[model samples]
Target: MGLKKYTNINNIQGKKGSQFSSQLRGINLERVLIVAIDAAKFYQKALLCNYYGDVLERPFFFGVNQDGLNLLCSKIEEARMEIQAERIFIGVESTAHYYEDIVYELGKRGYGVTIINPATTYEERASALNWSKTDDLDLYAIAHALIQNKGMENKLPEGAYRKLMKLTRARRSEVQKRALVRIQIRTLMDHIWRDYQGFVEIENNKPKKKLIFSDFWGKSSLFFMEHFPHPSSLIDLGEERVWEISKENKLRIKETHIQTLLYVARKSIIKSTEVVSAELLLLRLAIKDLKRLDENVGLLEKEIEKELLQTDGRLLLTVPGIGVVTAAEFYSELGDISHFDNAGQLIKKAGTNPIIIQSGGTQGFYGRISKQGNKHLRFMVYTVGKSLAQHNKDLRPYYERLKERGKHARKAFIALGNKFIKIAFSMLKNRKPYESKQPDYRIFTEVKKKLLYTKMNTYLNIALAA
Candidate 1:
């Protein structure tokens, strides 16, 4: 095995191990106290010990409240007085989100608290006590992990960073919910009109599948479905009436598309004609749910934009492929870029850095990514990578080169994600906007989207009357 180096705080195996070691450098072993806590939702168990594994206080339980916090503090003070400890190091297992309160409270009172990974504690226990387990044993494992510096100091986000984190996560949840609603609506559409979305048309003894609207959720298509869900209803309304409705709503639908839709309606089949009324009611309800989710998502994005603009993360928008939502989500996960010493640190944090393997007398080669850090952050980086690969003129060449070198598409995207981290790190650290060698057309695209959105809302209001 190679000799171990106790520097680089970015090491995935033991984050901030060096910092913890530096704090213990010339101190008397017995005088240094380590407090290990196993946190739960309602109560927590804490134990105090000296550097040499001498127990200073027996394990005790306290509720997760102000009174419980005071009791824990009193116990720590008593142990410190009895042991005459000059330095105190506290560690707590990251048990769900229950540990947040204790960590935040202890930090406020000026205690140096390290957030221990549960995996480290589990390994420490397995190595020491085999399969046996208990709260007391877990506490011992926590202390051992602390002694080895197997955790990182808690750095809680504040102000805009905190808001962005919460808002971005909320937005992600809402988006996922909206997607489920879309699926439900599609299921209902299939029941109501089996061939409304597309149908076979015969001409000169050749059959061709014709799509009335490329997007089933488009304004014109949705309006047609909402007002005239049944094929018979469309046939009765006739071509002239449909054209008048489109003109009145300013839908600007193509005449050919309208004719094709009517033809499909004449030939489309309904799964059950008797239950058509029931299906229509359910479809209207589903559409209402979709509209509500759409409004919620819109409101969330606006809030996210407000929070993002208040931080240095706003500079991320200068990149061609990045938008307000992507920039905000990426920045929310990466709080305070100064915490990272280099772009490599950011890559490691996202767990996008490749793993390496080497044997004796052989050159080391990279394997897959570690996949050990913030998974959400990793996903955001990967998304940004896909965007960059497809739309970024400056970065697309590098992505193509990776693919040409026999890298898989996903691997190429991951490599681009690491590059995005480097670019983002430098941009945030130096407070510079991205400067592309080629002209950035994304700005014009964004302006066009805004104009179209305004026009869409006006047409939607007119179509709602139909």
Candidate 2:
């Protein structure tokens, strides 16, 4: 069999009536006014042009504050009166957060605003054979994009969705900060107790790898780190004193682990006692910061849970592996589910959909994902995939099948992620919870309990104390 060749691929087009096309269909081009804006930190550049690419007004700068906004409104009204324009279309480049204020303000005034992607404007400029860039050039690019009906209606979400977006993004930042603190703590431990995290031990005249404690942040490990970072201190305290302190703090410490800590302390390398003492202070401070950050994260999680429950996102909890955090993050990134027509659109928005590449008389082939959509959404979907593969019995089999077919673990997870998107999309759109094909009593009972009695506050309280 011969390979299939990709031909006649140049005619790919976007769906009709998805942008401003429907409104412009029967309208006269001459009377339509196109207002293009290039936003900046403190000021913005704008120009007025008619629908037929004729500049009606030269590019002008306006401040981005209240007085400036009034000037902008007056300018648009003046231009409308001069041209006798019946329809007006305003386009602004989505430059960081600079365009947000204008979009919101204009939207509130009942002016139709189209948020243009910076990439679209750049391409428009390049097409005109003008490589040099400036605020003036950007205005022309934005105008051209709007004339061709390119841009999006970026209606900022309100109420609970807005709150979810903020909280979820904040939670991600806190998580990253916590991870950095963990790294700093490990670095300090390396200098103080060289073999604190893990070290090789000899057993039966053979090299064996051993960890003093299973988790570095476990209660007993944290107790030693807080009170006795230095080996000399651990040795000075003696096993009896260590046991007494552990009991006082209600910390469980294995006798074998304590003996191993003392052994490592005796033989471990060290610097001057003064140097150790200074590092200890920094280490304790870092630990304190870590604890505070953890509490903040727990509090944020509680808020996210409360917000998620208010929206349909809580239905995601019906899936065995999906949790409140993952659901909230996904929903926040996704915004309103009503905007998506299907699961495929959601996947495309996440940039997880595979790319199609075909050119030069070669057969069409699937390439890597575009990775051009919301990166946080992509991350959350992958997280859901990981959770489902580990805990969701129904989805685990599919994940295993992918691996059996020689897919890498990461690739398998992404495949599962796409499938999960379909599941989630259907669940959200239909306002239904997840249901397994085959009846399983245990999963049913667990899911029912989760849906009916989600005691999120209990976990938050424990986390706050920790």
Best by TM-score: 2
lDDT of each residue in 1-466, candidate 1, tens digit only: 9977566544444445556666777888899999999999776899999998888888999988889999999999998998888889899987877988888898888896887766568778887686435648989998988888766436666778778888888889888998998887778778888788687878999999878899888889878777777788888889999899899998889988889888888777645457777888888887888888888988888787666655677678678888778888898877788777788867876778898988998999999987645667889888999999998899999999999999998999999988989999998998877778885455334323433123434433432443
Compute each candidate's TM-score over C-alphas: 0.82, 0.84
TM-score of 1: 0.82
| lDDT at 131, model 1 | 40
Query: What's the number of clashes in each of the models?
Result: 0, 0
- The collision pairs in model 1 are none
**Runs in model 1 lying further than 4 Å from the true structure:** 1-15, 39-47, 51-61, 93-96, 117-143, 202-207, 240-255, 276-279, 439-466
The digit string of per-residue lDDT tens for model 2 on 45-141 reads 8999899878888888898778888888888999899888888989998787788889889888888788776667777888756553454777888
Superposed model 2: Cα runs more than 4 Å off = 1-19, 118-137, 360-363, 396-415, 438-466
| Candidate 2 vs. true structure, TM-score | 0.84
Question: Clash pairs of candidate 2?
Answer: none
Candidate 1 backbone overlaps, count: 0
- In model 2, the Cα lDDT at residue 17 comes to 36
